[model samples]
Target: MLLAGEQWAARFEEFQREAWRLETLPQYLMPQESEELQEFRDGTRIDPATVHNEYTDRLRRQATQGRLQGRVHIVTRPLAEYLRFEFAWYYAPHSLAGERIRILDVTDRPNPLDGVQDFWMFDHSEVVLMNYEPDGRQINREVFEGDPAKFIEYQRIAISESVSFEEYVTGFDL
Candidate 1:
């Protein structure tokens, strides 16, 4: 089943214990972010520390409720522009709000999770696969009805192989 609008947004709030995500794309073309992205590209940037938005609000709320929210993004070095924007604008602030963001840099090594698609796994049981076009435009979110054991295993591998977002960004200027 495809999830959209409130149905999709509710998953983050509905997860009882943990909400995890695996991000496989370097750029995600979200329509809502177009204007901000363009402004970023045009040399205007927002200080993540002072930025307040719905996402960060959600992260803060989840953290206050003692729920875990985490994600590991698969990426390569000499990062894409979109990845840079994402790191500076989204990841940085989200981390401050208590989201556990990790980076799996596949620059020199072979990708361990090469064929794995992007997905969100709620409470380690419900999986929602994120479908995207080649250029990174989001298509739809599909609920995966199969057993989520593989996704749980994937999460294990990702967390073990990746570095925390703070560690990953220490030397780089994003």
Candidate 2:
């Protein structure tokens, strides 16, 4: 079934134990990040002191409350500029706020988790696949009616093959 708009997106808050995501996109045209993306392109660096928001605040709360929240972003070396900017402004701060961030760099090796698009697997039961246009504009979220096992396996493979965002960054210039 297709879930549209804020109502569906808000499902992130309903996860009880875990809310894990697999990010396979090089860029996402998120409207909220427009100004930040521009500043990033203009060569300004992200400042950690001012990155907190209601979202990150929720992440912190969920984390301390023992709920697992994280994502493994599939990427390649010579990272896309957008990915770099996102890491600097979103991933890093979110990690610090208690959302785990992992990177599955597919630079020199074959991707272990191939053919995977962005998705959120919540509580190991519900799976929501994110649909995006070729240019990375979000279309909508589709809830899978199939078994969650496949998505769960993908999550395992991703987590096993990836590294923490901090560790991943040490190998790059970002």
CA RMSD of all predictions: 0.9, 1.5
Off by over 4 Å in 2: 171-174
lDDT of each: 0.93, 0.88
Candidate 1: residue 171 Cα off by (Å): 2.1
Question: What TM-score goes with each of the models?
Answer: 0.97, 0.94
Point to the candidate with the largest lDDT. 1
List of clashing residue pairs for candidate 1 = none
User: Least accurate stretch of 10 residues (summed lDDT) in model 1?
Assistant: 44-53
